[model samples]
Target: MQILSRPYGALHYRLDGPEGTPVVLMANSLGTDLRLWDAVLPLLPRGLRYLRYDKQGHGLSDLGQADRIADHAADAEALIEAVATGPVVMVGLSIGGLIAQHLAAGRPDLVRALVLSNTAARLGTPDSWQARIDAVEQRGMASIADAVMERWFAAPFRATPALALWRNMLARTPAAGYVAACRALAEADHRQATAALRLPAMVIAGDADGASPADLVRATADLIPGATFHLIPGAGHLPCVETPAAHAALMTPFLERHAR
Candidate 1:
């Protein structure tokens, strides 16, 4: 792991492959660390630069109080400027996707391409999301981690060792940090910004993803002119975890097509 100091706080990240190669910046969803990409990383073709980072208050990154998605995007920009060379292909999941949308729209020069997975342009926390946030805040992530796990993985995945590992990780997340992220999700609105993005983009969603259903994902793709949309069957919110090979297959073509 590498550490870089930014104005907001210290950022934790990992770099892989050659430095001069085209860069792909991978960002995790809310409550997840950079390790969330562990399965997908090995499937990616070598010889390309890759940057994976834990968002503020997750994993080894600083646990600061960030309430807005813009603040998160700024942090991501700081990390990109510090580590990557020129524009990058930004791949983000869930809340990470929201950050990517904000950054791609707000700072077009910094992004070469975008891949959003299991995310929506306007992921407004429904009544259930708010209730879950409140529950986590009051009783800690452990209290609701199981329920969240059920939503994240498919029925068959629940019986796998990976599921247990993921549940453990989610259960251990800091309540404060989790709640802060929830607040960010609760207040985010990327619909307008995503509609304005002209850069090469793709949207991938799990067919069984309840958080961001297929229709919503398709709607997001439609909002972005000429963006490609792919769906991974039998997977839920976390496709990288449930179906890493499919995730890589969908992403490889998009990245290769847009490679600089």
Candidate 2:
């Protein structure tokens, strides 16, 4: 129930682990909350602090007027400055990846490394995002939940009872918040900024992810100066949710070098 106030509203966040440890910040995807990375946290090594928060308009945070990734990035920057002991290993998923790009490029001092997961410099096209916005706004979050689920997970995972959890999570999102994030994705294109980055970085993609496919994600990785890319077979967009162990395995060593 920790909270941080900003001009927009209050941000809900949770920071775990003891004081003075290297911080690892986890940012959520669209239509999700801070809990998105819950399964991935414990799998990582100990001796590090974990910072996760619900973005404005998602989870328990206030829905601010700002709808741009830059605004979200600024919010993350503010949170890190107020809470983290120093630079952190930022793990950004989907739209969260865009925010991390902006934050790292603008406030390089706040980030020690990056793990851009199931995301890209730019996501769907403006027209595509506009259509998605129209659907959710007109028909509500439920209207797009099924389609989103398809892109989010593969067929096998969808059949499992666990899929109900994420499906329910999507159906419950605030339409206003979801729409705002869509607008941000429509306007975002971080290729230039991501390319200019020189920090230790990794880009991960689920082989079956329809939203940000492996090739698309690999392309984004290529833009980075030295970012390593990994393809998780049979997984979808949020591999951290679908296969946290695999996600953690790829990240642990990287974190050890940069974060610890």
Give me the candidate number with maximum TM-score.
Answer: 2
Clash count for each candidate, listed in order shown: 0, 0
| lDDT, candidate 1, 1-260, per-residue tens | 69988766788899998868888989898778999999998888777888998888888888677778887888889878987778899999999999999999999999999999999897755565689787987888889888788778888888888787898888877777777888888888788889999988899999888678888888999999989899899989999989999999998877777755
Worst lDDT run of 10 residues, candidate 2, spans 62-71
Superposed by TM-score, candidate 2 places the C-alpha of residue 3 at a distance from the truth, in angstroms, of 0.5
State candidate 2's TM-score. 0.98
| Regions of model 2 farther than 4 Å from truth | none
| Candidate 2, 111-184: lDDT as tens digits | 98999999999899999999999998788999899999999999999999999999999899888988898999
Every candidate's CA RMSD: 1.2, 0.8
Query: Local distance difference test, per candidate?
Result: 0.86, 0.91
TM-score of each: 0.96, 0.98
Candidate 1: deviation at residue 105, Å?
0.6
